[model samples]
Target: MRLTRRDAIAVLAGLGVVGGGAVAVDQFDPPTAETAETGETGDGGGDGALSATVTATMTAAAAVVYPSQTEGVADFVETYVVGRARDESRRDAMRDAALELDAIARDWYGDDFADLSADDRDSLLRELGVAAADPVADGTVSERIRFHVVNELLYAFYASPTGGRLVGIENPIGHAGGTESYQRATMLEDDAGRVERAERAGDAEDVEGSEADE
Candidate 1:
């Protein structure tokens, strides 16, 4: 389920989002200015707000569902769900249906779902897998947010530098080095040919320069 950085983002974009442990419990200090700028280059929008009530509920159930959320789950849902609700393209009826998805949490556990204990959170999210997949609910705020959260967990593991190295997934960028023993031969051949051609061209230029000097 791990995904390289590109793959993780692509997966998140495709899922429209998934649970992120980072969003709920991870309280990772926001990246420094430079790193935040880097994260923003590809992700168009950023964080949003949530109340203490909503946050506590999401910590258990929602955080497990999404996994790497840290303390930002509320922000994510606000952007993707409420923002979408406001847009003209989003239907009022569908928005209402989406809101209803949270009923399960309120009715089953009481309070906002986020406030539950870790064990409760784990229990709730595990239960959600079967329920969230139901298309009717999946499109709503409840599962819709969870869907994104799940991707975040997968992304964190896969996008990590060591994660990529562990899985033998090559960086599409082709600059990062790989384990020597496991190197792909085709990679070396292609690089060698490119280097050889560049060297030959450099030598030709050097000869031409020398002749001119003479």
Candidate 2:
């Protein structure tokens, strides 16, 4: 099944996967001073440090979910995933989720999640039913990983200015009036068409109401 951004959002929202907001996008801020120094926000770990294992697991997950052929994906993971996870109040949950993913990998392939081949990792995710319409309802460990880890990484990606450009959003939120040219993807164009149609329908209703009043 093809997963559009809208579908992902709706499914996550329905499952209450994105806590505290409609989407996890609002949960992130730019990296902090401490994050720059230590590559973490110091909230997820016991010593307020991010574990390398957790970092590796999340990075692997990001590769599967938002596989970019670009050179800076590691930087993106640090800036987006680590940076956002650090500031998040639910940072502990994110940490535990990473460990859980590692455990799953060890159980299935006798290796850590980061050590798995790309194909094997993707296959495992598929086996865990990550693409299921309502994985959360089952309350399985795999579903929790998908919700807490995969969804968070995905939010970090698509909400960033760089990720936005992939789907034709040049300036997502902060970088207004950016000069980068954007070619709207078919999905975005469809979204715009839906919004336009909804507005036109409302206007037609208003006109009919006015005529009836006359």
Candidate 3:
């Protein structure tokens, strides 16, 4: 199945990453720095952690991290990020990672991280050595980026139904199919009941025959 961004967002909503992807998608107005500073908005957190810079940075990262076929990358990442940033600590870490990423981008490419070309962004992440680093919330720049940015996005995707399916997990832990999942179990239960009834009937017939013989 081609993994669409909507599918990923559904999975995130099911996992409570965002309250509701549908609402977030339709009602989402990109937060400006002025609005964020005034604390007038943002479903993400009261502390205004879901800044425009962070949203843009993460969306750009998703374009690189997600499989090429995934659609609506920007919307999907923004929704997931807003929900994730609700936590004060997590929000702070994400903001820090975004700033650090931009700093690195300006140094190497003379641009913000989100403004870099896809190839350059990918190259920059590789240059930071995140693939080999141990993810640590309070570690070095590379480690923090790995923990808060790269690995964070990866974990959210893989844990969701869309990404989990790639690895042969039809129903990942968080996404239960409700009645659909119970269909097989229900069939087995009915079959067992029929077998028990047949056995009881046979036992009664044997007793009747034995009594008649005696």
Candidate 4:
């Protein structure tokens, strides 16, 4: 379903991001330093480490807008957020964008954003995109809001095993492809010879038993 600015904002607000606009955020400076060197889970993805109330609120808000939640999803953000989501300066942009989208939904629908049905959610999302087409739209709601939601949806929508199924990738890495020639060719050579010898011996024994019976 298409996502609207309000749906995104409400989800972010639920996550913890406060305020609005394109940059309603700060660097994701978790008071505790969970650097890559630490080799330990830190704030954002690790145990007990929470993000900026605002960023988290925003992330959570985006989850709601997308209407999906699964394990380890937030961790994907923790590992990748610092490196890829955006520049350090716009670290909180994702969260903020989500919140802004949710707020827009709340204002337009006159109800809690999460309470909407799936069909309702999609309709609102399309409307948000349409509204942004109008140059005179108010507030921070814009096509960019849709972009943020799209990013969030990419993550949230794919959080399910169902999503993985859709993409044809299994959870655990399967065996790397193998060569038929290398697997049994060498190992079975001696084993097959031994089996043939044993079969011949067994045939001789069988002939002796048959003659004795006759």
Candidate 5:
């Protein structure tokens, strides 16, 4: 699904972003000094917007994690990241993770993470072993990236209507289809089919028992 900037906001709302869109998530670690130092001294200023570097790194990361067919990815990712970063702790963690990714990118490819090709971004993430690491707030670089960057982005996308459709979910949790949606005629039909099959099996068993008695 093609996501507009408005759709991205709705996605954040679905994730329980409230109080003027400060951002919310099911799990995250409190801000640490390390992360604070990373952001406090960086280019993300007092305007409450995410830093350009953080936005670029996150958008690049989302491209690697989202389906190749995903549309309007750059807008969706930037909106989500900026909104989510309203929480100071979350923002710091994201900034720290983005800086780590940039550091790695420069070390390996002599370029920034956001500047690397898509294949390179994917390769770098795999090399960091984020795919295999459990996300922890203060864990290793891979773990922090897995938590603050990759996993959060995945959650935001999959929880949105567009992303959920890719996986055959017509309505993800927060989008609101209502009870009628759950009352599909196909479900009743399946129940009836099961009952019919059970009756047929019961009849066949009864007939076999009678024949044995005879």
Candidate 6:
């Protein structure tokens, strides 16, 4: 089933996944402006840190999940996922999700997800989605990937200004161009006849009153 941007948003919202306040991974300081600009997480920061490897994995995952017919997907992922993620814990979740994908790849094919052929990577993601949907299992890794990684990425893309344009939304939330005021359809034209009739009745009433006075 091909999911539209709206559908994806609804799903994420329904799951209570998107707007939750940030979770702190640890005491690691947030990314500096320079680090964010460079898209590097710096060195020796452990599981919570965003590294080049994590960035690469996220880039690959974004490509697979939200493939654009046009280009600039890498930049989009960097801006939305790496740069604009709500807080450190959110970033950590993204990093961990990528690592989870790698772990799944290793278990299935003896390779990292990044090393897998495109077909294999896609196949593995499909399986991951299936596993995530099991009703009996709650808070499983598959469920986390589905919500934290895949759904979050989808939300980020569609909620972005560029992604919004793809689906005909002018400017999304953090950018400019949101509607200043929502204009409702006016019924002036449809009500024109009724207005004219009321005017005529008032005129007739005035004439009758004048004649009675005389």
Clashes of each: 35, 0, 0, 26, 0, 0
List candidate 3 segments past 4 Å from native: 1-50, 174-214
Specify the poorest-scoring 10-residue window by lDDT in model 2. 20-29
TM-score of each candidate?
0.34, 0.56, 0.65, 0.37, 0.70, 0.56
- Stretches of candidate 6 off by over 4 Å are 1-50, 84-86, 130-138, 172-176, 180-214
Residues 1-214, candidate 6, lDDT per residue (tens digit)?
1223232222222233343333222212345666667665432243444355565566677677775463565544543443333355665666666677778888998987777776787788887763345422235777777766667677666654345556755334543224421242422223243323323323322322221231
lDDT of each: 0.36, 0.53, 0.61, 0.39, 0.65, 0.50
Best by TM-score, which number?
5
Question: Roughly what TM-score does model 2 have, to 2 decimal places?
Answer: 0.56
Better of 2 and 3 by TM-score: 3
Local error of candidate 5 at residue 12 (angstroms): 1.4
Sorted by TM-score (best first), the order is 5, 3, 2, 6, 4, 1
Expressed as tens digits, the lDDT of each residue in 113-195 for candidate 3 is 89899999999998999778899999999999999998878876766555665665544555444334334533332224322
Cα deviation of 83 in candidate 2 (Å)? Answer: 2.2
User: For candidate 2, what is the total of clashing residue pairs?
Assistant: 0
Give the alpha carbon lDDT tens digit for every residue of 1-214 in model 1.
3222232232223333322212221111223465576742112132222223332333334355444533444433333332122222322333333233345667777844555566765665566663445333246554554443443233443433323444555332222233432456443422343323323323322322221231
What TM-score would you give candidate 5 relative to the actual structure? 0.70
Model 3 TM-score, all chains together: 0.65
Residue pairs of candidate 6 with colliding backbone atoms: none
Q: Each candidate: RMSD to true structure?
A: 16.1, 14.7, 17.7, 22.4, 18.0, 19.7
Model 4, residue 116: distance off in Å is 2.8
lDDT of 5 by residue, 1-214 (tens): 5754444555655554533412322112333465456643222233223356677788899989988887898877766776666566777788789878888999998999999999999999999999998999889999999998889888888776566656765455764443534666433322243223323323322322221231
Q: Say which candidate scores most in lDDT.
A: 5
Worst 10 residues of 6 by lDDT: 205-214
